[model samples]
Target: MAWLSQYQAIVYGNGANGPILQGGRSVTEQAIISSETRQAPQGKMSALALSALGIVFGDIGTSPLYTFKTVLGTAEMPSDPATVLGALSLVLWTLFVITTVKYVSFAMRVDNDGEGGILALMALLGVKKHHRPSIVAVGLFGAALIYGDGAITPAISVLSALEGVNMATPALQPYVVPAAVVILLALFAIQSRGTAEIGHFFGPIMLVWFVAMAVMGVAGIARHPMVFAALSPSYGLSYLFSHGMTGFLVLGAVFLCVTGAEALYADMGHFGSRPIKLAWFGIVFPSLILNYAGQAALVLEGAPTDGNIFFRLCPEPLLLPLIGLATIATIIASQSIITGAFSMTRQAIQLGWLPRLYIKQTSSEGYGQIYVGVVNWLLMIVTVGLTIVFGKSDNLAAAYGIAVSATMLMTSALLFIAMREIWGWSVWAAGFVAGCFLVVDSAFFLANLTKIAEGGYVPLVLALLIYGVMWIWHRGAAAVSQRMREALIPVDDFMKRTQAAGIPRVPGTAVFLTRAERDIPPVMVWHVKHNRALHEHLFVLRVEIRSVPWVFGEQRLTIEEVAPNFWRAEAHFGFMERPHIPELLAASKSLGCTVDLADVTYYVGHETVIHRDDGMGMPAWQEKFFAVMERNAVHVSDFFSLPNDQVVEIGRQIAI
Candidate 1:
């Protein structure tokens, strides 16, 4: 989905600097501010922790429903206590090291102001394309892989949850795929309504899920007390060496346990680190450990390995209810993944890595609750298709951990840079600390790489496609920007020529939207040359999207008079803030340039790119791809929220 991958999407509330125009009236999104959830009052800590359970922990929280079973299935060895204990140990320590110690104890501390995630970290580290491009490409490729992860999450989660039904009764097996498709379709269908009204229930529902998992786990563990030996890291290490390649391959499956750990770091901005930590330590961590142990205990005590061992833990009387609960939990988990995709897409668009699209805000009271039809529908198609193709959670499991493993590996790399540059750590110190993570991440990535032929290519293929779009889009945009700069008009020279030519001034205010931040817009120069006239009050406006989440009102605009009745202006929006020219201009009124919004004429540049066959440019394939993307990108009028009726588009063609 262009919406999802290009979200590679950055999303945010437009602006209170100026409100968004719905049908006609001015409207500001009430609850989309990044800061609102960041600085909660002391009383809201418990509430935030509860909310964090829903948004941050959904993916990992639902892991128990499928993870332990999948791990056992992948190991494909006898279910003796020694093997069971070793697998359990690997799972427990993996949870502790990856989720608890690394993320909760460390990565959460590395925040961009208050936000987290790869992009936020990139912005904080100032990993610009010019300064360090390989690193930027790595960061972007990792971020793009997240979309691959996003695509698989819903399919695997929901499919696994519904598989519990087949666990209860084999006769109903034929219905699982269709039912999952229906559930996924419904989930995507309701995305446009936003999650504000129903989101509040997420935390409470997940809390119940954790409690249920813990209870069932305790019951299972009571049957085989010896299974608790998995707590020792020695057994996990022993398991890895004893089984040779099989143990190493098992690490890939074990990785599924903490695949969602990145979300804790990424979404730390939403609920803050403290609440997330509280939720993990207080509820999620214990629940997961207990549940995985429970599944292992059931197997150790002679439970069948083929049918769902997770459902085996539940008493026959309660099996149906457990199935329903697991299904609901999976849906919640899928929702979080989809919402994340939407958010990342908006970010990618704002940062110039993707073509701009019409981003629809779905909730006034929801946090980053927006929907892209393209992203939603495409994700739905893929998710449903995977359900049909893979057929069983076991088959889909082969595809699950690959993308997230690579993403985590990349995050570890970036974390090393942050330690060196941000924390001013010595290279050796950063290496030692990051090296431990690298061992785990690298092991898991390599292990998962073994599955590429077994459907792991699904996410990798999706990720590569998305990454290709990002790479091509960024390079093409740079070329276009360079071309415009090469052809720019010097303001002083233009002024002298205009005086000599005695150009006539038109009435009212005219706003020319430009890409140049410090140079004269070529579109304006082209306009004067052809039209041979200028507006009495003209503003050369350029919109700048900053590297942070929200750029506040006081710091949003800057204006300077370049010459008589002509102004050079820059409107700065955060990556999380949408750019609306009318509202941006309205904010300029506060800075001494007063103009009536109703009467102002907005002029924008329209580029028609022509691909070149020359050997000097990008490969011919890339040239064509970039041209197609540019041609299909959201028009300048809609991206900047200009008044369509009063807007004029001037066309220019360039070869890239």
Candidate 2:
């Protein structure tokens, strides 16, 4: 068993790097170089647009499935004709201002070197090396919002779609919860199977769904043509100010329609900025607006007064079929948000803002299907818990938009900075755009705050927990490293003592899997002392992960032979990626016979951190968090993908 494990690690080394090693032979020519000279496979703009439209917009696209229904269910959205029209107007205009004008037309153009999303924009704006603390907090909060959304997306999306079944047939209403549970469970259960296999069908299905939404809109539009008047901004403004504080309160829930807009930019790297922009303009935008308008029209024409506005728009004969399609759309929508959460976590891990979690890549072709077992199960528990606690889509709706609105506000702030610093745009230009974004986003954010007593606190509480853990992890890691620096054994002193003792030299390669980017681990010093000789080639590798999701595979790893046999390779991974060191070692060997794995011995350094008055920003409670995290982190040998027999573990003590 031990020999088998050793051989497995050696043979599988670099297999994760994708085909660099086959039949134990290195394929240097086959390797993909991550440079301008290397071009990604191309596709037609139309195909790319359709694909991006489906994958990126599912969450936002399916908002029409329940946003209007949920808003109308609220007490603030009046049953009266005037106020109802006003409320509908507000929803429509909010979509235009926030989703269409602000994000679709403007924000999508502000790319961070062809990368988008909150973190990439932050990086482009130089968030880290400058006003780091404040910007990092903002980024963390933005990240926390995604986590909050992740928990609720499955519950809300699945429940809303399932509610359509009950809408179509009151007989099925009794089975709604059970049906929803099964669908939600199935959605998550397939995550480990990788999305690429089924991913191709996503676009075609969504396109059909959008057409169905548009057709439903056409039906309602014929009945009440005047409902198109909601496109004017005056009604929205009137409703916002006329109804006083109550109208202001409903803005929070109204903001739910655009909860998934950020995802469009976050996933820009996958399908390219142009394709997403085209899809939003050409297909997604019109269908969603029309669907919402159709719902308003249906309500005006005195259609049976059912709660599910979306499914109600379809003809009676097609109700069940529409429910089936809506359920599929909602599942895709939930899948996008869940995958988005995975991407955000990966970015956070790379930027040193998150504790390393076990990340498993579940795809051979598509980068999207990733399973973080810990995150997946935890989110499932939270999602199911929320479903039971809230018990209905309306209750969950109250908690939905608060985190998203806050994150949007943060993105606007970061965008303002990026305009001034990165693009060198004039202050007035940046301020003008920033001010409009702030006004709209701030209204939604403040409105959400009003719902704290009504379930909005869930996400806020979750965000604080997530933020605290991140802050503590960063502080503790820094403190531990600082202590190591102070206690570092100089290379000269160690060799003198080991040589004086006449220790026998070991003739094998020693590999230490380290986490630090700059500092050498304590284990490296000890390994040389105990053996009294260096392997033919000694390496100190640093793996750097970028904050963006879906980094090109070839760009995923950066290897440098910093010194003779002293190589430093920084493995870059998306949050959904799994780390396999043996594969990296094998890949490196293929590049050149710089390090010999046949005679190699892997070394891992294990550290135990003790907390003191450390003066790191943490309170006593957070110190305990650090203790818990240390206990749960993957053990050294297991984490390094090393053979236990050949592996040497060195323990170091540090006080945080």
Measured by lDDT, the strongest candidate is 1
Q: Candidate 1's residue-wise lDDT over 47-98, tens digit each?
A: 6787778788899999887787777777757486777888899999999999
Worst 10 residues of 1 by lDDT: 6-15
Error of 1 at 508 (Å): 1.1
Residue 395 in model 2: shift from native, Å?
1.7
Question: What are the Cα lDDT values of the candidates?
Answer: 0.80, 0.70
TM per candidate: 0.94, 0.86
The C-alpha local distance difference test score for the whole of candidate 1 amounts to: 0.80
What local lDDT does model 2 show for residue 374? Answer: 72
